[model samples]
Target: MFSKSSNETKIAVLEERLTSYEIMIKKIDEAIQIMGKTSQTISKMLAVHEEKLDNTHKNDELIIDRIKTMESKNTEEHHRVIERFEFIDSKINDRIEILDKKVDEVTKFRWLILGGVMIISFIFSQSSMVVDILTPDTDNVRIEKPR
Candidate 1:
């Protein structure tokens, strides 16, 4: 009788342990399902981030190309402006040279006219003195005695 009761108690204890083990396995399965869902969510987020990064890279390349094009245009425009300034400077130099020549001609003409006037005045004065010395003046004659 004691041995039968002991075997029965051992069977009951094994059954309780089996039930607890089954509950633990169910909890572990639930945790694994939740982890699977979390991993899927993380994977989706990573995929979205990768697409955004690709788009940003493309936009950066376009921006760099636009900047390079603008710089090329600016360089060409700068060269054109410099060429225009040089042309204008050459024209100004040409005009200045012509004006200098005209000024020099005018100065020479003025000097020539002044010299001609001085020569005429000197000749007239000398001729008048010679005429006065040659002409006789009888209205105011006077005699002087020498001692």
Candidate 2:
């Protein structure tokens, strides 16, 4: 009877150890499933992030292209405005030259008219004095009225 009890005790201890190993194996499987889920989630998030990065890169390229186009257009417009200003400058210079010639001609004509007036007065007048401020010179002049 003592030998039979010892055998039964050994069997019980073996069964308990087996049960503990089984439970440990189950826990390991659950942990492996959780790790797989976590890895899958990380992979999905990484893919989304890569897609967003690509979109942002494309948008940046588009913005750069637009800026280049605007700069080219601005340069062309600047060139056009410069040419127009040059043309206007030349026209204004030409107008100034014409006005200068006209003013010279008017001044010369005015001087000529003044000289003609002085010569006519000297030839037709009896007195040589041009402008008398105080009184008129009547020393050698005589005037009579017939009635």
Best by lDDT: 1
Model 1: which ten-residue window has the lowest total lDDT?
A: 129-138
TM agreement with the true structure for every prediction: 0.72, 0.70
Off by over 4 Å in 1: 118-147
- The digit string of per-residue lDDT tens for model 1 on 1-147 reads 569989899889999999999999999999999999999999999999999999999999999999999999999999999999999999999999999999999999999999999998777667977668667765976778987
C-alpha lDDT of residue 130 in model 1: 60
Tens digit of lDDT per residue, candidate 2, span 59-98?
A: 9999999999999999999999999999999999999999
* RMSD of each candidate relative to the true structure: 5.2, 6.4
Error of 1 at 123 (Å): 4.9
TM-score of 1: 0.72
lDDT (0 to 1) per candidate: 0.93, 0.92
Candidate 2, residue 95: lDDT = 100
Candidate 2 has a TM-score of 0.70
